[model samples]
Target: MANVLPSFPNAAPTARILHFHDSIEYESRIMYSRPVAKALAHPGHTENLGLGVATARFAESKAPDLHLSPHRDNGDPCVRVSMLSAVLTNKALLNTANSSLKEHYPENFKTRNACPLDMGDLDRLGRWHTRTVFTLGTPDTASIYQREISRLVSLHPYLMHAVLAMTAMHDRFLQSSDLPNFAQSTAIECYHHGCAAALFNAKLSSQIDPLDRNALWATAVLLSSMALFFVESSDPEELWPLAPPSPSHLEWLNMNQGLRVIWDIAEPISPGGLFHDLAQNPQYSYFQSKMTSEPQPGIDGIPYYFTTLYDLTPLSNARNNPYHAAVRTLASLLDVECTPFTMVKFLSFPSLMRPQFKALLKGKDARAMLLLAYWYAKVCESQWWIKTRAILECTAICMYLERYHSGDLRLMQMLEFPKARCRLLRSGTSRA
Candidate 1:
């Protein structure tokens, strides 16, 4: 039998009991969390028929997946929910089930404490297992998403929930127009969103390990992507800079700062870590190397005059002008190809951004807003999570600039790129 470690060794007795109970519930919901051959009887009520024992045996025979149940949802021969009910009635039933589960699932207790997944949650997880994970990055990094992330999910429930939250939100976005039952699905997705973020935030406050560091970093990426998933209306007039400042304004930008903090904590690029090879191409290393307090101009992609608008000069650099870093960093990308690898690198720029740059964007600084509009115009179609908000918000920025800063021909001239770019995006034309 595999040794099931105590989930919370130093936790209070109540916490330990609750953790045990939740572990049992996870087994019950995920089709025999107790994958042992022994029949667990609820003290006295039912005979020990061991109907699920054979299914568990078959599951074990096939080499079960760590986070997922091995057996099919149907043909249980016994309904597992009955075991959950038995545990509720008799507190000792969990010990019986826990011992039974020890043979199969040793390290699953911590990650399975949440309420059991319904059909929708199951569907979302399955989609992630099969599809969404692959899309999060390039195929070269598939091992990180598939192998490393699964290993992390086995160790950290927060990472598991964070992955689920991203998949759920992705699923929600895909089905928003077609699914008539979106409101119901949204409620479930919101539960995932809440648990994933709340637990993740809590975990960030505590001391962590190397593996924990990886898990936290992975969760931060998902959270950042999720931050973009929750924008308000598609209307440009309702968005920030166009409308009055609201709490949601510049959320994606601010969320990136959190990602940077976790990145420092995680040291993903340091030797031996899972994300050490995040820069898939040699050319992309300029992004990691070129970050300087004193940066020069004349870079490509964003117009030369754009940086000049912020009064970026040798004396200013990033020290005096916030736009210098934003402009300089964005300029690095013009030479790199926008493959799946670079796309991930591309989206992460906000994290490396100077706080003041993001602050200026939040304050609706015309220069900052203009620069951001150019960025969105460049990458609006780079990834699915970025596309909707990027396209919509870029258009909003253009309108805001045009509406408020109309007389300035320099600002108007700059608006032309993002305006034409967003027009192409909405028209379904590919920039590449």
Candidate 2:
């Protein structure tokens, strides 16, 4: 202040401007604004931003109710949609992988061989390949948009509800628009629609009466039929009585009695007998046609099909009968170890011998005792000697006794012996 010098006001202002400009120029020299802005503007870069945001939101949301740990947040509709889409797409990927394996390694693709491949390695390869292929066609902007949408959905349940409601409404509108043509469809189409209607009605009926005995029985029968179909398709020989005795050989035999019972009860009430209805229905006509196209000849030149019954007892009882002779011939053809003489005697002699034996001993009832012994001997000698066959025979005998004698406890006890229990355990462990 003591050394005050005369100075123009404009001079001070100019100096200050110069100092500000120098600082600005220095800061500008080190900065790269254009490249940074371009990167932020780029589609791929934007997608990364969107993905990050979505992931963060998902991480913050509540877990879902499932057997496995929740894959995404409960509140995030975007995540749910993404996960569902992924699951669907994964199925397609699996199909592609299967096709590829079939094409390149046909022999290895068979059920026997395919069971042992390293699934983890295959999955990794499949994921990498699918991701690379998808990336090629996808635009960064679209990817970014999808990512952002997914994130938004993941965070908001209302958005998901709205989307689903809109979709359902649109579908209803389309369906209503086609109402005029619905009744004028062809017979086949009409039948298909009727079946669909029946199924829908059945579902509603089940929901209304959850514990309906008939409905439960129907479902059980349906499941059993499907199991039989799979078993039959895998090995047609199982359906034939000709198959040699093995641990696995008797499974169908064991199932036969239950299947018969199911058939007996459900057949009358069902639209028709299950197989008969299936054969007649146009929807299943193709499958029926395939089954009938190459009918296999059974014993006595009879064409074998699912519905055909081959009763050995009746055939064996008719002495000097052509069918009896045919049974022996069939046994020989099947390489089963059973003498025709023994088979004939077992069938015919037992019925004759038991009554006389019973009359002789009033206190012990010799006839019933003799019948039991004879039946046991016949079972031991027959082609159905396996554990499964024994179990099946036991079941069949139980059914016969129940139907004819109102459930004989003695016969039931005989069926549940320690020997049968041991056989069952052994059979359960052994495989074909």
Candidate 3:
């Protein structure tokens, strides 16, 4: 999978960095999810697709109706993948993997290194410094995640473990093949995270100052992204909903919800805290603004086909409708423009989904899946971590809904939009 990083995208960089009132820089991406099947022309964990502005114009074009193609009942989805990348290149990505990251994030490198580790662990830390850390957040928060958070590693050992664990998990995700090395790397990933979580939990049980609070918040963010990247299979059927239920099924959503726990406990709201900078980030503020401002009381912006599928009548509301919250949130997503800043609104759907809606999705409720599918299609190509998980899950949802719910014309009709949109996402890898 790491092999795909250097060559996949051929699209000219349509993404232009925008400056906010605060003069903060944010990058615009025409995102496509990483490869699963022929979804991306390259193999790897992140779908850093070069979907240029032209593709965005195409995304806005009316999609033709497409039926659900049959799902292959057998092997790994990526085994048949023959995508040849156009060599996805950007200034940051063009940097050699072995190059020093300190120059890019000079603020984060502490005078003292994380201690008591062998060279193997140190190598992983180096990889994080060079690549993994930079891609962890949006352009605005990337610095905070890479620079400010790294400085915290020395003061909070658990934060160091969390960073190592995330780096290891990223390495695990990048491998296209399932070798003995895959299992070994996975074990390493688990050990570091387990240690991080243990120490973190211990610290939370006691007193925490503003600095500890910031460290814990940053660690939680890393762990949360890791929790989502923990894949059961590259194939959708082999994953949850279709696969038997376990404690870990859709645990990413649970992890998403769990982030607030640390946030509430560690109110890193104190001035000068690292998280304070994160809180002030324009990307988040923009998302919260639209979320709070979108009018509700009905799924007004949601298409009639989806409204009918969910049984959301004129009289129905958040109190009685399971799909109410999810649909309402989806409407808010639709209400905004799909800018780099606004895409955060779409990616945040899982966290905002109500428990009843989440349960319906866990049960493979077709309506719920349709809603989720639409959300996935909208933002699948946007972020590295999201693209990490979105590739397979989005592909699976499209296939699953098409195969089983084919008879329901309304469901299939609504499904057409996401399916078509997802198709466009696949092509985004090479579009110029």
RMSD of each: 11.8, 34.4, 17.5
Number of clashes in model 3?
7
**Model 3, TM vs. native:** 0.64
Candidate 2 minimal-lDDT segment of 10 residues = 47-56
Write candidate 2's Cα lDDT for 94-160 as tens digits.
3443443333222321332222112222232232222311221114322332333233322322221
- In model 3, what are the clashing residue pairs, if there are any? 1-44, 1-176, 7-85, 7-87, 8-85, 31-381, 32-381
lDDT score for residue 120 of model 2: 28
> What are the per-residue Cα lDDT tens digits for candidate 3 across 230-313?
565655676655666765566677666555455454555446655565567654555234223222767667767667778877
lDDT for 38 (candidate 2): 30
- 2 or 3, greater by lDDT: 3
| Model 1 per-residue lDDT tens digits across residues 1-432 | 122222322222333323323322222222221222112212222332211101112111222232334254364645445444433433333233234423332133234432332333434455676667776766766557666765555446566666666776677666554211212334334445555554554454344445566776677777667666555666677777787876556756656555545555566666655656765457546435422234464333455675567665555466766777778866776566656767755664665677687777777789888878877877776666677777878889998898989998888987898899887776663321
- lDDT of all predictions, in order shown? 0.56, 0.28, 0.53
Winning model by TM-score:
1
Give the clash count for model 2.
5
User: Against the true structure, what is each candidate's TM-score?
Assistant: 0.68, 0.20, 0.64
